[model samples]
Structure formats: structure tokens, C-alpha cells
Target: MTDRPNPLSDLNARSREVFRRVVEGYLQSGDPVGSRTLTRTMSEKLSAATIRNVMQDLEYLGLLGSPHVSAGRIPTQLGLRMFVDGLLEVAEIGDSDRETIDASLESTDHDVTNMLDHVGATLSRITRGASLVLAPKHETPIRHIEFVSLGADRALVVLVFADGHVENRVFTPPPGQTPSSMREAANFLNAIAEGRTLSDLRSDIAGELKRHRQEIDELARSLVESGLAVWENAGESSERLIVRGRANLLPESDEGAELERIRTLFDDLERKRDIAEFLDLAEQGEGVRIFIGSENKLFSLSGSSLVVSPYMNAERKIIGAVGVIGPTRLNYGRIVPIVDYTAQLVGRMISDRTKG
Candidate 1:
């Protein structure tokens, strides 16, 4: 394997400290850090000129960039990577934060999809960044199935999975359908749905009808087909992407350029397919993954950072991912741990549900 050069090794203590301070300042204020600012923040008595020369050297290495010719420096994407990989000191999640997550997730413990939505909202509220949650494709066996009449033309199908997850889907009933036919249809589905997944049941429906054609009538058969058709369409939706707290991404001051970038990000968030593809990067590995600006294609145009981690199932299989998106100057030290903890909590809740 080829060895990647350690840029931290090239820097002496003073240079590293200056670079760290500049990046931290930029992350905190979302603005450039001048030499005068670094001079005061430094522990040792270094002149602003000394700090300026260090900043210039750091920029020469492509780790820092000056937004304006005369302005102070901000961490380039490479510089942010360097700091995150080498110098970042992640703070521990405080008890209050832990309580917040626990309380939010527990409130919707009975409903798995609702639990995920709450997780996204909670992360967004805490981090002040838009949260994206990708719900894993559910393949659990059907435990119970029921049909409820909504009106003359519509019915609701409630599916209970073996893992204790419940899904409610509404479908249109065929013409001339009645209460007895719906009940008969429910019975027919219950008879065949045992120990089979939604997709499995959908596939087996045609064969089941062929075998039991005489046992069921046309009305019941139509209702069954319509009901399963709804599930078939639902099954095609393997993964559900939930995005919340987009308003958090808007800058408080709302500069014209920044608002344009935020608008671009909002547009990016609306493109669920692109966001899902981008999130696939997180599921490829373990633990928290950081994608700085332009590192992932979805956020490239927005110039944002994503701190993502994959949540697992009972068997420790990667099921889905959760993360936040904000400007490149994200508070990595704090946000990293928050994302990590949230992922773990989600996994635990899923595991408990599976066990139950």
C-alpha cells in the first residue's frame, strides 16, 4: 500500500497551533481569522507578523485560503480534513443531550417510522443544521393484516410485521366491493400471509389465486389484488428518506450570496435520489464519517459538510444512516459526537424492537 504523507509531521508546534486556532475561529464565527486575532488567542507571546507568516506558510501548503486578497485565512477543505483527522478533540455528549435523545426516541418507541422522524427532528434542533434520515428497507415477515373501510371507494391496510413494526397504507377499493367481501379478502390474505414478507406475499399472490381460484369469489379476489397492489407499490419504495429542519440552515443575517447557497442546498435536499446516493457513502464503513465540502457530490454545489453514521440492526447489520448538513464551517468537534450518539441510540431502539 502506498503511504500517504503526514502533513502534520511537516508542521512544527507553533505552525500547527496557529493553524488550529485559525480553523477553530472560522468554525465558530464562519468568518476569516486574521493574524491579529490569532496573536491574541495564542498562549505564547507571538507578534501578529509572526502569526501572519505562519498563516501564509499554511496557505502555501494549500491547507488555508484567503477569501479576499487582504483578508485573513479560513481553512480550505483540505485544511478542515487535516484538522478533523489529526487535531480534532471531540467533546463528550453531555447528560442533558443524552436525555434529550433518549426522551425523544422513547416517546415514539411503538412506531418505528415515527421514531426515525423524531430522530431527524431532534438532531436538527440540537445541531442547528438540517438533518437527513434514511429509513432502512423493512423486510420483516407479516404477523397480522387487517383492512378498514375509509369510505365508499377507499380502504386502509394495516400491516403488523413479525418484528413489531406497523405500517398503515391506504388503497382504493374496486367498484361494487362490500363489507363482507372486504372481510373475506382480509381472511384470505391472513391465511396466506403468515411467515412471508410483503414482497414475498406480493409475489405469491398470483400463484395463490391460481391454486385457490374456485375457493374464493371474484369480489374478494378483486379486493385482494387491489390491496396487495398497494403493498407492491409500497414495497418498491425500499428506502424512505426523511429530511427535517431545513430552516436551520438559513443564515441568521441572510447575506445575498449565503442565501443563494442555502437555497441551492434546499434544492439539493429536495432531490431525494441524489441525497440517498450520497448517503450510501456512509453505509460503506463503520462509525462516524465526515464529508467536507465537495467531498460528496450532493453537497458539492452547496459547499456544505456532512457528519454521518450508519445505524445497525439487532445482528449489527447496517440498515440506515443519519446525519446533518450545514456550511463547510461545521462545528466538527461537537457535531461528530452528537451524530455518533444518535446513530447508536437509533440502533439500540431498533434492536429492542426486533427482540420484542
Candidate 2:
């Protein structure tokens, strides 16, 4: 790995101390800090004038900004990123929270959708913000496959999954074969595909399509092609995204502008494809990822942030992600470890179930 230059190298000890206090204060209260406040709080008794000079220097460096002409200083998005990356003191997830998460996932009945819903709800309760989970996907096996005629040409292909759910697709048959022949085809193909997943069955179907056969007719051949094509076109059906606690994103204030931002963020979340694609990026990394305001294009307008981590299966391949979404000035030190542990716990629990 290459060593990148540190931007804070130029800051003197006094300036760094003053910057840290300012950012910490702002994170705790979401309010700006005056020099007098820092002066009284510091271990060393520096005069208010000296603290003001350091604050001015930090502002000049673009780490702090003032909302009003004479208002105290608050850390900008850049300052928050710097603090999170270089100076924040992360807290370990408490035993209580860890137990809460673990107990919920202890059962391994394998209802993936319900498990993810529970995971999201747990994160929201812990962090007081919206939670997102990218669901893991695998090759699902089918218990049965049947073909039913809808009309003269259009046919319905039905798939019965091992989980007891059924999926139906409209299969268009080629010209020259009767519905009765199609029934024969469905019976023969069902016998072949009953015990395999669509992925595995596709290969078998491909092999059959490759060779000449006396038992298969034109419509039966089309039925095989179109049935497989439907599942192929379904496109990542096993993997999905689940979000909860959207109402948590809204702050308890009457400020119309902030409320408008929350509304915009809700709209962004409704478009799952954008958020899902962004979460997919976290799979490339090994641990928790922080995307500050304006860093992720999807949330730039809403001025939101995301802290996400990818979870893996027993094979160590990343199968999904877990994350929190909130305002830019998140409680980074406290929340980072919580999000990280949740990801690890989720991966461990899912991997254990898979092993069973």
C-alpha cells in the first residue's frame, strides 16, 4: 500500500486540540461552539481570545464554518470526514445491544425475508436512524415444474419451489404442435427438472436442446427454451433490499427546510435500485465504509450519509450488506462499531445456518 500525505500535519498542537473540541461539541449538540465554551472545557486554561484565534485558523482551513456573521463555529462536512477518518474514538458495542441482536437471529428456520426485516429493525432501534440490509441470494431448488395451456399459442409455465411457493410464467410456444403434445412435454421436462435449481436445470436443458431427439416436438422444444428464458430474465430475484425506520430519519423540529430534506430523502429511498447499487460498492471493501455528505451522489441533494458493511457466507464470499442512513453529522464514534458488529454477527449467524 502507498502512503498518502496527511493534511493535518501542518496543524499545531493547539489548533488540533481546539479543532477536536469543536467537532466533538457540535456532534453532541448539533450546535456551534464559541471560544469561551472551549476555553472553560479545556484542561489547560487558555484565554477566550487565544481559542478564538485557533477557531479562525480552522475556519480558514475549511474545516469549520459559521452560519451567521457572529455565530459560533460548527464543523463542515469536510471537518466531520476528517474527524471520522483521523481522530474519532470508536466505542465498542455494549453487551446489551449485542445480546439483543444475537437473540433475534438465533433461530435458523431460514425465512430470509423475515430475518432481514428483523435485522433492519434491530439496527434502527440501536442507532435511532433508518437501517438497510442487502439480502443474500443463492441458487434456489424447485420441487416441481408444470406447463399449462392459456390459449391456442400462449402457455403458462408453473414452478413449485421447495419452500412451498409457486411462480408462474407465460411461455410462448412455437407453431405446429398441439396442446396435448405440450402437456407431454411438460410432464417429461418436469420429471427432469423436479429436483434441481433453475441454474442447474438450465444446463441440463441446454444439453437436451443441443442433441436431436425423437421424443421432443416443435412446441415442446419452444416450451423448454421459453421456460428457462423466463427464469433467466427474472434477474437477481433471490437477492433484494430491505429498509426500515424511515420515520426515524425525520427530526423532531418544525423547520420547514429540514423537513423538506427528509421528504427528499424518503423519495430517494423509494428508488431501491439506486440505493442497492450504492450498497453493492461496499462489497468491494472489507469493513465499515463511511460516505459523508456530497460523497455519494444519490444522497447529495438530501445531505445524508451512509455507514455500511458487507456480510459474507461460509465460503467468505460477500453475499449482502448492512448499513445505516442518517444526516451528515452522525454519531460516528458510537455508531461505527455498532454497525460493524451487526455486519459480523449477521454473517456469522447466516454462515452457521448454511453449514447446518
Candidate 3:
């Protein structure tokens, strides 16, 4: 990871003011900034020539770029990062925005999937950008495990919880497995897997079996191993990533070339698996991971940006992540704090549910 540089002190007050006006103008209008525009936007007693000189100084530092020789200047990704880091003032989320976020998450329900769906949608609507929530890979404690023979090679594994919730999965059984061995395997699973999470149970059973290599019948052991492998490989964790309001990422205007960029971004979003995997890396970090244009390959081609933060459980352990995605010059000041707040809100909800 490249170390984030502090370029704020590199410029004087006047230079910073001029660069900020340029960046703010470009961000708000999506149009390049000229010396005349800067002179008008600022109240200081400065001429267009002075403004042009300051812009030239900023351009020399590789912060601003010109699309053509005579075209007005726009902030490059580096310039945007500098502005966000140094000059941008984040607008506080008002009571209305707070009410929106709080109301959407208001429920005593422990149905996490439903809540995550709401979270994704609310963030999308609030930010007017594509939003996504990387749900935690929380494991449920097992009540019992059962194997029903479907044929010579396949068997259905019925996982029943103490709360009476049941989930079923089918897997290939060991060669020549019989009903008697399946029943015995189920019994063995029940004895050890009680009050243990699915992930822990797999490890627990495997460790126990290794210790007592000769105690269990070979057929029963094979069935248990198969069940573990099947369920663990299902990838339910990645499946729970809720992405919403992707259509909001489209360009507001109808310029053919500009419209194609947003279209490319939409196409990139179809790779949810890749997005989720990239989000997993975001989970490994602390607070508010900002991936600017071309900084991360996921959004490089689309010229998009991402603002992500990890959501945690009661144990203070990071479980998943949440974020918003938009154009490279997306409102970082506004979206960063929103993403941070939403992550904290979701973390609190998980903690509350865990306590209940």
C-alpha cells in the first residue's frame, strides 16, 4: 500500500485557495476551471493573470490537468485526493439524513439478510450512488446433523438448529455408504457439534477424529468429512453482499463518450464476486478505506471511486464491510463520513442483536 502523502503544507494560503476553487468548480459542475472562473469565484483582489499563474503552479505539481492546450483545467485523481485530504469541508449529516438512516435500520428483527437489504438501499438513496454491504460470515450453532441417502452416491444433509430452524444441503456420500453408517455418523455429529458453530464444528470434529483414529468406523467418518467439506464450500458469505441502486451510477447527461464511461462502470458491477472479494480486503483495514481512481484495479477502467469501512461485531472483531461507489470525483467529504457513520450504525445493530 502506498503511504498517503500530506501535500497540504506544500502550498501557501493563496495557492491553496486558488487550487481549491478549481477543484470545487470541477466537482460541482463536472467542467474544467479557467482563470476567469477562479477570479469570479474568489473575492480576493486577484486578476485572471494571477489566477492563471497559481493554476500553473498547481499544474506543475501534477495536481491539475488540461484536456487540451487551451482547455480549462480539471483536478486529476491526485489533485482530488489532495483536496479531500487537505481542503474539503464535510457537510454534517443533518437531522433529516440522520432520520433517514435511523428510520431505515429501525427494527428489533434479527433477520440480518433483511436488515442488510435495507442498509444497502438506504445508503444508495441517501448518497445517490451505488451502495453495497458485505454481510458477516457469522456461523450458527448446530443442533444436529442428519444424512438421508438419495441414491448410491448422493445424500441429503439436514442441519437442524435448537431454535427449530432447519437447513438442508446435498452432497456426494462416500463410495458404498449405507443407511446404518449414515445414522451412526449423524449421532456422532450430534454428540460433538452441540452448541458449536458450523465452522468450529468442522474443526472440532476433525481434530477429535484425528486423536481417536481407531475409535470411529471408517464409513461414518467419511460421511462427516463429506458433510463438512460440502457446507464449507457453499460460499454463503460472499452470496450475502447486498448491492443496490446501481442505476444511480449512470451519467446524468447524455454525452456519448461520457455515457459510455458510466456504462462501462455498470458492466464492471456485474462482477459481484470480484467486488465482494475486493471488499474482503477492505474488511482487513480499520476505518474509511478510500480507493481513488486507478488506485485500485476494480474501479481503474471505469474511472470510479470507492469509500469503504469495516463493520464489526460486539467483540470488536471486524466481520464485513460497507461502502458507496460513484465517479472518480464523487463527493468524498460528504460520502466518507456517511460511509463511516453507516458502518458504525450497522456494527451497533449487530452488537445489539448479539446481546439479545
Candidate 4:
């Protein structure tokens, strides 16, 4: 992790104002800002020449850069990080946004997948940026487990959950396995699986088997291990990653290189596995995590930014992450709090469901 800079301390009042204006203007218009424009917009009586000198000093300090020789300057990724970490004035989430989020999530009827979809769609709509949601593991209790023999080498493990969700996993039978061993494996799972989640069962399996090691043979133990391994390997089924509003990332204008960048960002978004893995960085952090431009590997090629936060369950354990992806000039002051509030909202809803 790179150390974040505090450019404010390095700059005096006049230079700080000029730098802030440049960054804020770029964020607002997605274009470099000229000193003449700053002179016109600023309340201070500074001339364009003075502001130009200030911008030159900022540019020398690696905080601002001109896209072209004659063009105005914009904040570098490092400058954006400094502004977000030190200077950005984050706005509180409005009541209307809260109402919108509450309404959208409540209508999902406690379905985990639906809730995540609604969350992604709602955040995308609200922020006008692409949204990503990594859903928590489903905690639905197992209703029954059945192992049907598939010839001599493979078996089909059917798991029926209390939520009426049925999942089928192909299990490879152990050497010298018999039909009787399959029945015993299924019976053992059924005996302990009722009203327990797959995560719970997975953890308890080792303890349960160790306690009753004398009762079960090696073949059935291998069958159980293989069956659970198959399920564990199915990452998508157990923990879904949802992305929405990718079209929002496309700008109405700007062809050529900018268009190419958006295309690259679209390609990056297509790899849900990579994005989901990237979100693990958020889960490790305390609150909202911001990745600007090259700070994150997935968005580096696209020159994009990410604002992410992790959501937790009733016990305050982080189980998933949610975030928005946008161009580097994203309104960090606004989007940061929105992401934070959205994560908290999701945690509350999940906690409520757990209590119920």
C-alpha cells in the first residue's frame, strides 16, 4: 500500500485554493481547467497570471498536469487521492436518497440475490456509475441430502434447502466404494444437516466425524469430503457477484482514446471474478475504501476510480462488499458518503432479517 500524501501542508492558502478549484472544476466538467476560468469563477481578486503561476507551482509539485501543452491542467491521480483524503468535503446522504434505497431494498422480500440486484441497480441509478455487489453466502438451512450413484466412478449429490432451493453437485466416488457406503454418507449428512447452513455444516463436519470416527469407515468419509469439495468449488452458486448499469459508464461524447478507455473499462467489468477478488481489499478495511486510477489493478488500464465498502451480518462480521466504478473525475465528496451509507443500509437490512 502506498502512503497517501497531504498536499495541503505543502501548499499555502493561495495555492491550495487554486489546486482545489482545478480539481473541483475537472471533477465537475471532466476537463482540464484553465487559470483564466479560475479567475472568473473564484471569489478572490487574483488575476489569471497569478493563478497561472500557482498552477505552475502545483504542476511542478506533481499535483496537476496539462493533458496538452496549450490546454489547462487537471489533478493527477495522486492529487485526487490527496484531495479525497484531506480536502474533500463529503456531503451527508439526503433523505430522498435514503428513502429510495429503503424502498428498493424492502421490495426484495428478503431474497438475498434479489436484494443485491436491487442494491446494485439502485446505486448505479443514484450515482450514475456502474455498481458492483458481492453477495454474502446463503445461510439457508439444509432440508435434505441425497447421493445417487452415477455408474461406478461418480455420484450425484442433491442438496435440498429449506428455502426450496435445490442444487446438484457431481461427486467422484472413492476407490472400492459400494452402494451401501453412499447410503451411509447420505444418512450421515441428513442426520446432522437439518436446520444447519452449509457453512455451519462444513465447519462442524470435522468435529462431528472426529467424535464418531469409530462408527464411520474411510470410504464414506472420502465420499463426504469429495461431495463438499465440489460444492465449495462452485463459487458463483455460493457467493454471487452482481454488476449493473455498465452502460452508464459510457460518455455521450468523446471518441478516440477516451472511448477506447471506456471500452477497456467495460472489458474489465466483464471479469466479475477479478472485480470480486479486488473487493476483498474493502472487506479488510474498516469503512469505505477508495481506489483512484492506477491504485487498483482492475481499473488501472481504464484510468478509473472505485468507491467501495463492506457490509456485515448481524454479528458484525463482514460477509460481502458493494461499490461503484466510474471515471477518475468522480464526485468523491458525494459518492463516498453514498457508498458508506449504502453499505450500512445493507448491513442493517441483513441484520433485521437475521433477527426475524
lDDT of 1 by residue, 142-197 (tens): 99888888999999989899988788878988777887888898898899888999
Give a tens-digit lDDT track for model 3, residues 230-294.
22322343222121333543446333333344335435445754665686669776788778888
Misplaced by over 4 Å in model 2 are 1-5, 139-277
Q: Model-by-model lDDT, in order? A: 0.80, 0.75, 0.77, 0.79
Q: Which residue pairs in model 3 clash with each other?
A: none
lDDT of 2 by residue, 52-80 (tens): 88888899988899998888999988788
Q: In candidate 3, residue 171 scores what lDDT?
A: 94
* lDDT over C-alpha atoms for residue 265 of model 2: 41
> Which residue window of length 10 is worst by lDDT in model 2?
226-235
lDDT string for model 4 (234-287, tens) is: 224233112133344345533223334433543543575465668667778568
**Which pairs of residues collide in model 1?**
none
lDDT of 3 at 75: 94
lDDT value, residue 110 of candidate 1: 65
